[model samples]
Target: MAGRWVKPEVFPLFAAVGAVVGLCSMQLVRNICTNPEVRVTKENRSAGVLQNFEEGEKYAQHGLRKYVRGRRPEVMPNLNKFFSDPK
Candidate 1:
């Protein structure tokens, strides 16, 4: 009979670690492809340091930050609003 190379108990831990690594790698690839600051075009290469710094600052606002900019500061917005409402 063939011997078991890996124990069954450690499978879930391996899966979780793989998932985290995959997510991070995908995010990095997405940023590399979409983020202008990371790309060096002919115009960008010729620009001065101050211009590059300003451009970096302009693109530094990530998608998540833009999404949350208008959101209320609450852990559970709907639940909190429901309970806090005066009847």
Candidate 2:
């Protein structure tokens, strides 16, 4: 059946590497999309926090688009106040 475990000894090392490469490409797509900054090498996008829902969503959409377009994210995170993070 599908996904049956195959004995490692049955395949050459290169075969294992090829299979890994195929699987890794899918992971790469996810990793590329998840970053607020769509930039693959830089942190250009960031999730923004705002006091109001309208403003917060506005920036979130901006950030999301930046990555989707392969551009840098301009989202500005909340900088107006600070709170002790939950322990």
Candidate 3:
């Protein structure tokens, strides 16, 4: 079986399978070429919402500022009372 040519009966089967595969590939190519919706274009491509890194950084900075503004004086009060402590 190593070097034997394909049997005559099997040759027709192989040809039929090859023809079906070729027709399927041709139809796939034609569908891709004829269908505008299936084609890749800039308008159809999704513009990812997270594409802007700088805008995200700005929002983070604004949030941090708001967070710090609420607790700045409460967390870091003036230290002048240390020397004025009555002992």
Top model by lDDT, which number? 1
Clashing pairs in 2: 37-45
Candidate scoring better on lDDT of 1 and 2: 1
Best by TM-score: 1
TM-score, candidate number 2? 0.28
In the range 1-87, model 3's lDDT, one tens digit per residue, is 843667776888889999999999986885566443353566555643335566455644664587786664553355645655666
Question: Per-residue lDDT for 10-79 in model 1, tens only?
Answer: 7898899999999999989967876655655777556644445554665677778899999988999889
TM-score of every prediction relative to native:
0.48, 0.28, 0.42
lDDT of 3 at 83: 54
lDDT value for model 2 = 0.56
Ranking by TM-score: 1, 3, 2
RMSD of each: 4.7, 17.1, 25.1
lDDT of 2 by residue, 1-87 (tens): 533546566568659898899889966775577533344543432434324566445546665476668633435334322343443
Worst lDDT 10-window in candidate 3: 43-52
Q: Global lDDT of each model?
A: 0.75, 0.56, 0.63
lDDT of 2 at 35: 35
Considering lDDT, where higher is better, how would the candidates rank from best to worst?
1, 3, 2
